[model samples]
Target: MLEVRCLLRSVRFCSSAPFPRHKPSAKLSVRDALGAQNTSGERIKVQGWIRSVRSQKEVLFLHVNDGSSLESLQIVADSSLDSRELTFGSSVEIQGQLVKSPSKRQNVELKAEKIKIIGNCDAKAFPIKYKERHPLEYLRQYPHFRCRTNVLGSILRIRSEATAAIHSFFKDSGFVHIHTPIITSNDSEGAGELFQLEPSGKLKVPEENFFNVPAFLTVSGQLHLEVMSGAFTQVFTFGPTFRAENSQSRRHLAEFYMVEAEISFVNSLQDLMQVIEELFKATAMMVLSNCPEDVELCHKFIAPGQKVISFVDKAQYICCLIISYTEAVEILKQASQNFTFTPEWGVNLQTEHEKYLVKHCGNIPVFIINYPLAIKPFYMRDNEDGPQHTVAAVDLLVPGVGELFGGGLREERYHFLEERLARSGLTEVYQWYLDLRRFGSVPHGGFGMGFERYLQCILGVDNIKDVIPFPRFPHSCLL
Candidate 1:
């Protein structure tokens, strides 16, 4: 039997028999056609599910989607194949000659020499059909098959690209990437929401689990990354994080991914803000260059009328205008969107505000920093001129997602850390975190960006639930 195994990023070669490699038939894609002039007259083998099938009396046109790029491969399958089985979502492989000019909207079309059905999907029950629009809720329920859709496939692809770019940007900057533990006894920064675990088969009591101590899914990797930064000078951790909040908004998910980076011996908040701006700009440029197909999909579905070419051009222009936080706010206020409220300094930004800024202003990308500490996390370093207890924290809000990142310089001084803890009324549960300060500490800073939220920003996806493969939102946790 021919076998196939799928990995998260790369599909693996799965077969019992030795496979023939005659130039390893080039895997032509729907996206390949966009650059088809390069693949002219090449014999290619394309593998994907049929996204949409149009069968007339003379020719059968199958829109094959491999989730490689946002577009679909136009395959001209002859009437020799049974029309009944050649319906939507059927996995198929087409061996054909690539044609550069297809006389259609698509730039490339496959003149199929042969067609073979790898896995047949029933058209009647195919969740994605040719007729009506499906609700987002219904699609979420069928996540296993959601990627077959053009929009979801585009989102996943863009997410993968953005993640790669993140590593590339930081690694190129000489920052070491670290992996933080998922289950640990210590609550790093003493944040309230944690999902505790029980290790010994079952729990007679919460304390009787592993190590006779309670462990929970980590909420943020900032604490451990901070420790690593003390030793390595610069480090980052990109991984999954969980929050047990029960809020059912589209933005909140119980389990999500986070990208965290920490640096040591930073001069002041200005240095932090500078790093933040550079990182966001690099990310935007990276996405624009690497995932133009996915970016087009984002504009098509998430924000209609948003052209990828225009967005990149505008972003570059607006990024120039955003020298200060006040300037960013003013640009956001003047944006052409139906904003429910106005954008101003000291006011916590909403999703609408961020969308306006990214879609309007200079349009490349901007980093709004120096938020009022009252609205930020407790671990941020207190600002010199701010009111009592406010810290030098920053949240990086992007175009589509309001607060894509949350982080700040940690309270390095033991006395100040303890005082802040007591003042916030969270002293009792964080004695161990306090002990880290007592033993040996350094002036360290970092921030956490929700991995899925970052994906949403890049792909122009609206719902947090869509980016994650299996979502764990309030009132729903199903595979």
Candidate 2:
């Protein structure tokens, strides 16, 4: 009876030994599996859209992409497992053993054990056909599906990395991120190109409007950042800004993202310029280091074989040239190149003038500082230069993108700002802005950067629309 009891106990122990601990589902991203060191012989599940497929009697090959990386993960399947639904653009869930790939394109591939099509795409009717490169302009027509193409995918990935890099730069340097309001009563740029906000349909009286007085989509977040800068010392904001300029040029957009920063107690314009230069260099280096493949893909598709210098290398070697606006006008006027707009002393620098200036400075970023007060907005500090009558303003001109950044020392004097506001007929509208000076004002300054333009500059993309996911221009608001 004791021996029988022992035998029963042994049986019970053996039955409860865990049974190899099978998982419900072991899904791995193509990116993680490809970069995994010891994933060979491991049963892993992958889900992605098929990029291409080649079926044969003995073995079949499938190229799948999950938008995690530039390269597609190759999947090797047996002919018996092949199905008619394994077509291009079809989304599938694959369970397979990871194995070493013999192909030179990738290091590891999946040997499929089971395949299930989650969604089958109709290849015949799909807008993005297989194995054909679509032009950027043609892709813009299908904004909804443009992301499936390799070019757009690459551009977006780089854009995300660039954004993260910018935030990382600021965070590392102890700058606080501020979210400025999208709708406000004051026009930040004072350019009078605001998109006015109103009640639904129509309203009988202005007081019956949503925000009471005139509210508009903000042109810039500079004022809000300045408000935050008073408390945080260093504050920055990244958000959508709107303008109703009605410009159809390649460089104009009705809506875009802006990166604005404000620093308190900044003594001179050089301090602001240093921040801009360092921010650009740091962010460019971070992106180049993290997303070299994406950047390379952009260059390959956008400007084939252009032989442009790497972003990191350019940032390291190219010393940013700081020239006064008066000096820039002199240089542009003396240049042999013909320009559509003549570079006058007080005129704002046109695209042609900016391009000429950058080229004249040996294809490096040029900073034109101390712009004429008459041309700049009212917030720029008035430089006490007698004859020139300039403001402490600056514009950072890059090689491909004419103007990547623009800013200056803000006019923090209460009386000066009040007079300027009254002269611009905006004193009542910006009474709160003047209050910042009245309470506790210090010598502060900042700059604003167009996020899309920065992407175009870094990637060497010619068209602004291609860089931005959804190009918002006049009368062209497509999904």
Candidate 3:
């Protein structure tokens, strides 16, 4: 039987037909074609998904978008070149003459010689229709098809450009980028809102846990970035973070991206806040300047008359825009607007308080520092001020978005960390963290900025879900 099988395989290999061969043609993206005025009258192949198809008796016009930009290229084809498959949302390829458009709406257009439909869309079954201004909530249901919309396409481009700008900022500032672990043994925030990680098919009992320890999706990468900051002096990480938060609010998400940076030899909260301000300002400016068209599309539709954040040199250079958390509480207490959660020194600040505080600061980014130590994590450095104990922490509150960033100087003293951990019974679990303090520990601090909030602040987007490509919330993890 083995010999017969071998003979059959050999015969099949010899009798198999060769695959078809085709020459690859040079392609032109809509963005490049629009920019290239010198390429007029040249023959080129353009490929993209059909945005709008208008049929006439003599001329067939189609607006195609390749997601390279917000603008779509106009393809002017003969009426005879039209096909049933060339409908909205369908993909197509065309060999055409690039010429000046007769209509002033566009500078140049594609005068097509050959038209081919690469993929067809079922218009009736499609969840989205062309040229319809669909609400963001309605678009949320169809995650797979949402990017095909103009709003989402522009958002994704802005997101991509912002990501690149972040990397570029860190690179130019001599900061090392670290890819922190997605799965960690310790809950960095200690919030108890962790997504416990386990293998897919098997439910291991307490006696036999995977890797012989409890692990979870990390809520923050600050601790891991701290480990690297020890040697590098400056390190940054930008990636997805998970929190098992059950709230269905517009701002909350189960999975979101965080931009975290740890700087070594930082003694005070002021030093850490400077880096945070610069990082946000530089990246936001880059996104605005590079993707102007995309930004305009989002701002015009989602947030009308919204202006991008403009930070001045002297404003950021000076730290006068900061207020102590105690002062913030006092201001909130004096506010006429009744806050759901009353302003108190020991309690955490809510969104209403944050909004009031930002408004009090002339709608500028306000840095609220020295939060109550009892509410903060064990990692924050203690103020040691009697009666009203506070931590060397800071939270950046913006006008549109409440709390955009939060961070503080770490507890670098050995005795302080030991006692804090002992009080919480985390001494055994975070021994590796303590070990870093034992030898050559320097004063270090870091901060984490919510990437989605940054986008929201810059683009004037209302919901956090609209910024991210695949939003993961309480009960929704659509593909």
Best of the candidates, TM-score: 2
Ranking by TM-score: 2, 3, 1
The global C-alpha lDDT for each of the candidates, from Candidate 1 onward, is 0.72, 0.87, 0.88
Residue pair clashes in candidate 1: 257-451, 314-362, 315-363, 315-364, 318-362, 381-392
What TM-score would every model get versus the actual structure?
0.79, 0.94, 0.92
Q: Write the residue-wise lDDT of candidate 1 on 193-312 in tens digits.
A: 888886554455553566667778898787777667657988998898888887888788998888888988875766766666666667778878887767776676676654444654
Clashes of each: 6, 0, 0
Q: RMSD for all candidates, in order, please.
A: 7.6, 5.0, 6.7
- Tens digit per residue, CA lDDT, model 2, 372-439: 99988889999979988899999999988899999999999999889898998889878898999988
Q: Write the per-residue lDDT of candidate 3 for residues 143-182, one digit (tens) a residue.
A: 9999999999999999999999999999999999999999
**Candidate 2 — worst ten consecutive residues by lDDT sum?**
305-314
Please give the TM-score that candidate 1 achieves against the real structure: 0.79
